[model samples]
Target: MPELPEVEITRLGLMPLINHKVSQVVIRNSSLRWPVNLALNSILKDMPLVGLQRRGKYIFASFPIGTLIIHLGMSGRLCIASKKSAVQKHDHVDIIFNGPENKILRYRDPRRFGSITWTEDDPYQHKLIMSLGPEPLDNEFSADYLYEKLRNKSVCIKNAIMNSHVVVGVGNIYASESLFQARVQPHRPAHKISKDEIKSIVDAIKDVIENAINKGGSTLNDFFDVDGKSGYFQNEHHVYARKGMPCYLCDHPILQITLGQRSSFYCKNCQK
Candidate 1:
């Protein structure tokens, strides 16, 4: 699934489509995770996409009338397509813009797990996104706030941080890398971690996420930018997917364990 960095990259790459009027919406196949609205054409007709932004993993294409929310589920991607481009298999939604450029934003998802939804009201208040945790890179996700959130929580540190309510966009791959960088064992109880250690984890989370974004995000599976560019962050990973390999810091072998049904890679000698 595309995480925060990948989503942000998608948003940035699609900036050219912003401020363009929606001439038409072509829903080739509406049977996504949630049905693509059949009335999108009528709803978005002539509405200019005034703002393009991302929150967590969702991209919000804002217009004066309302906003269109897009989630690139487990295997979804948006590409800038020409007006005359051929329609391929699994091509779902197409928002054709009315401008001199004559461009189209095509959404393709092999798994059909993505969604395209619209709301006339504030999208931030929508039930789908209202309950989400603070953005990991924002000021609300500070070490003190994280400490307060984890207090008395007996869940394992990895699971706790991975919790959407605790911090948004800390996916399995980045979580492992962040914990490894923070020198904390993934299975350690959240409450057992000291405040100093929590601070380190907080810093590690921000550093790991920023670094991943700088590298265009990890291309573990089908992740790609809006321009079909591959992310190279996976190559710089310290422990993720290096299960039995030698640790980069210490000579001890990196270990892999299953926690919360997700594979966690860590250096036993380096990460305590």
Candidate 2:
């Protein structure tokens, strides 16, 4: 699944082409759980795209009428391509723009988990966006907020941070990497962790996310930038997916554990 950094990077990549351009919205395949074409066409036909932004893992395209909210579920990605290019498989949604350069933006989701919807008043009022916590990069997600949220919580630190209610878009892979960077054991109880450790965890989250954005996000399989290039963050993994391999820092065997049914990787000697 694409996280916040991945989604933000996509928004940035798309802003130049789609912003201020009148879009020709086409929802090719909307037969999924939620029929998107009808809603998308009805709302986006004449709306000029004002800007592009992200909240958590969702991408928001502002328009005159409303906001277009996109969620790249487990295996979904949004790509930008030329209008004349031959459509690829699973190219569900296409938003074409007749700019001076004549470019086309496409949304291709092979797994069909991605979705498109429109919101009039506030996108957050939408059911999917309503319950999400603050963006991980926001000031609201400071160390004090994290410490207060984890107070008296008995869940493991990894699970605590991955909770969307605590903070958005700390997915399994990034969570493990951030924990390892902060030297926090994955299985440590949340409340038992010190305030200093919480601060470290907050800093680690920001650091890992910034690093991933700089690298264009981890392209484990389906993720790609507007240029259709894979992200380079996976190359900098400190502990994620290196289970049973030598830890980079301590040379100890990198360990793997399951938390909240998600596989977590950390260095047993270095993290704890």
Candidate 3:
């Protein structure tokens, strides 16, 4: 799935389209997680794109009359392409813009899990985004907040942090990497973890997530930036996916375990 970092990278890649007028929306397939609303064609025709921003894993394209909200579900990729560019098998939707330099904003997903939904309603108040937890990179996700949220939970701390209500965008890959970095055992009960460890975990989550975004996110099984490039951050992995490899800090074999049905990698010795 495209996490927040990957989504943010896509938003950045589409920035060039801002301030341009929508020429039209072409939908090759409307059977995404949510159907591409047929009404958007009439609503967004020639609407000036005013801004673009990301909240959690969704990208918002702001316009005078409404906003287009996109979610790149498990295997989705959003790219900026030339209007004349050859469309491929999975090129599902295009928000074609009318400007000499701007490109066609395309959404593609082999799994059809991604969505391109529009709202004349306020984008921030949309049902999908209204109840989301704070962005992990912001002060709203401070250690104090994380520490308090986990105070009475008995679930594994890994599952707790991965909850979007607790803090958005800490997905499976990042949850493992952050817990490993913070030296917290993934299976440890959330309420039983120490305050200090909780603080460390909070910081680790921010660091791990920000580092991935700065590096353009991890690309495993089929993530790519708008430019058709796979990410290099996989080289930065310390424990994630290194099941039997030597630990980065303790030299103990990195171990892999299943938590919440997701593969979690950590050092048995380095992470307690």
Candidate 3 backbone collisions, by pair: none
Point out where model 1 deviates above 4 Å. Answer: 217-232
Which ten-residue region of model 3 has the weakest summed lDDT?
A: 217-226
Candidate 3 residue-wise lDDT, 113-182, digit = tens: 8788888899999999999999999998987888888888999999999999899999988999899889
Q: Clash number for every model?
A: 0, 0, 0
Q: What is the lDDT of candidate 1?
A: 0.86
lDDT (C-alpha) at residue 50 in model 3: 96
TM-score, per-candidate, Cα-based: 0.94, 0.91, 0.94
Write candidate 2's Cα lDDT for 85-123 as tens digits: 788778888887766665667887778877887778788
Q: Give Cα distance to truth, residue 257, candidate 2, Å.
A: 1.2
Judged by lDDT against the true structure, how good is candidate 2? 0.79
Q: Of models 1 and 2, which has the larger TM-score?
A: 1
Error of 2 at 49 (Å): 0.5
**Deviation from native of the Cα of residue 251 in model 2, angstroms:** 0.7
lDDT of 1 by residue, 1-272 (tens): 77778778777778888888989999999999999889999989898989998888899999998888999888888887886788888888899999887889899998999898888899999888999999988989988998999989999999999998788899998899999999999999999999999999999999988887876633422343344553334558889999899998887899999999999999989988
